[model samples]
Target: MDTLALKILFMVGFIAAWAIRTPYQKRDKQTKRLAARLVLRERVLFVLIYVGMVILPLIYVFSPWLSPADYHSSLWAGYLGAIFFAISLWLLWRSHHDLGRNWSPTLEIREGHTFVSSGIYQKIRHPMYAAFWLWCVAQALLLPNWVAGLAGMISFGIMYVLRISNEEQMMLQHFGEEYKAYMQRTKRLIPYLF
Candidate 1:
């Protein structure tokens, strides 16, 4: 497919993702937080993630500023990206649906947070992150721009690396042995293999 078509597809996926998260985000604001680690570093990383995943990609889609960094990808790759995008959307929905009120944008436990170990959470500790990895792969294939395409992975990778251990530690502190057993049974992002 042509680059314009690919960009349109990416936008559709992006909008769909936003649609999926909007209600959850709205609801999360009403949920009381029992614990939070929204430190300055975390806040900065979150902003970087937004810049990489949302701003840069949107700029690439809407303007020619990133065209100098554009690279041609195979048509098949774009098709593969569409598939990945679809799966990512499904996983995103499932993750949010399964977690429900337990979901939060930041590192915090809600007042009535429960240990979720069902559905997508059954095999992996973080289906949402897995969905994001797929989304990043999809973006790289769909955008065709070096900076915009790869930014999601780069920024999210940094955040994941810096935050995942702390996230798990928080879970450990909250759930204690239950989380440890869950950790023993499930991989962080992948199932069985990782």
Candidate 2:
């Protein structure tokens, strides 16, 4: 019963976010025409990534019961997680600010959408995803609640895994040589040497 309640709470938050921002921000990827070029493995991987994050934590929390005492963390570790998460949040904020009208929940790249190569984009291609992952790690560390932390990290990771690959493929199809050059110039998710 307790586990189910926690799962409900987690889902409520996820649904709330998807509802509040995703619908309004969605844009067309224009590169969907290149769908023929995508590999079957990639498509399968994408689905797995999406569902994995959503369901993985549920397995641990809602399916198998766990408690606070079942998990543990040090204050220092929590603090470190907080710092990393703060950095991640900052990155996420900047990504949103920079994206402006180009933001969307689904894979949508507008007809006039140009690749962003400046600001945080200069260092990392997927600052938003990186931020999400970082925040997940932070949540996991700070909460020290196995279920909550796992859900945060897993869901965020799943989103990133799907979005990054899809976004990259779309960019490659849309921007072509320019995107290639940019990829060479900047890292994928990490800022340096990643």
Candidate 3:
């Protein structure tokens, strides 16, 4: 398929995946918020990531931008991008499934949110973030524009750097020795390789 077709396909899948989870996420959000609220930096980072990963890419793909022909990768690369996207979709769904009510858009913990360390979470403390990273890689490969292609990594990179430690700290505070033990056994985003 052509680049536009591929972009459309990927975006549709991405949006659909989120749409399927929207109801669950909304229900999850209605729960009472506990401690460890999202700081301003985390909020700002999320906004930047949404813009860079979603809005910017949509504009760059549909509108005429500096997406020079030189930046467009080979057809093989697009196929690879599709593969990455598929992996992202699977990981995203599984992350949500494993997280269940434990999932939150922000850093805040839910009432009765158990420390999860099974399924995808068994080896990766943040599979959703891993999914997002895969999405970024897929975006970079699928999109041709330098700005659109790299925006996801840049956007998520900032959040990952600033928020990960804080998140782990919050988890540590809440789960204490259990979380620390989990950390000792599991890597942050990758499995047995971080």
Highest-scoring model, TM-score: 1
Q: Write the per-residue lDDT of candidate 3 for residues 21-86, one digit (tens) a residue.
A: 797778875888777556787779889999888888888877776456426468877888888988
Rank list by lDDT:
1, 3, 2
By lDDT, the best candidate is 1
Q: Between which residue pairs do clashes occur in model 2?
A: 28-109, 29-109
**What's the lDDT for all of these models?**
0.94, 0.61, 0.84
Return the TM-score for each candidate structure: 0.98, 0.66, 0.93
**How well does model 2 score by local distance difference test?**
0.61
The digit string of per-residue lDDT tens for model 2 on 1-194 reads 24344334445444543444453455333223213333564566456545444454444545544454346455576557656755765776688767765665456555446677777888888888787677567556554465656666666565565557777888798889989999998888886768
Better of 1 and 2 by TM-score: 1
TM-score of 1: 0.98
Clashes of each: 0, 2, 0
- Cα lDDT for residue 69, candidate 2: 35
Off by over 4 Å in 1: none
Which portions of model 3 show Cα errors greater than 4 Å? 66-70
